[model samples]
Target: MFTLIYITASSVDESASIGRKLVEERLAACVNIIPSIRSIYHWEGSMEEDEESALIVKTSHELTPQIIKRVRELHSYDNPCIISIPITGGSRDYLEWLDDEVKRP
Candidate 1:
């Protein structure tokens, strides 16, 4: 089973660092880094806004837990955003490629 994990990081460096780590560990097939995202949310009873980077990670469901754990360990935020959405459909070849990219040696 495959999944799309979405996470928001406080800075571009953190996002890139995490992306590199995941790909190196075969925990993620690919990670798309989107920069300069504006986020507005309530925190500590106050509305706040900040610029953030979004990381869209492609990986298998079997690796979600480990991915989440690593993200939390490396994240700077007190409560970082880590969400996973199951991939219900995709091209067979692309899916196969994703599988191969994340496979352990």
Candidate 2:
């Protein structure tokens, strides 16, 4: 029941802070932070574009809810982007390592 959680933050520092909290709290096995990314979307009936940071979190499916909740608490956006994707396939060893790193719910 592995999963990858994708989250967008206003800046690298914010993303890093959230990532660090997740890892420290044992809610995530690993987190990859993309320092800079351009995002274009509609907000409040207007097209908006901005530079943001992306965070990829690796952990168990059971932890997704808590991860989402935690991210919301730390996020700045009124509606932060936090989505989870199931890990249907991957290297067995790495997956096992992921399981080992994150606490089982």
Best by lDDT: 2
Supply candidate 2's per-residue lDDT for 40: 100
| Model 2 alpha-carbon miss at residue 73, Å | 0.6
| TM-score of each prediction | 0.94, 0.97
Best by TM-score: 2
lDDT of each: 0.92, 0.95
RMSD vs true structure, all candidates: 1.5, 0.7
Model 2 lDDT on a 0 to 1 scale: 0.95
lDDT tens digits by residue: candidate 1, 4-87: 999999888889998999999899999999976999999989999999999999999999999989899888987899999999
The regions of model 1 sitting more than 4 angstroms off are none
User: Candidate 2 lDDT, tens digit per residue, 1-105?
Assistant: 899999999999999999999999999999999999999999889999999999999999999999989899988987899999999999999999999999878
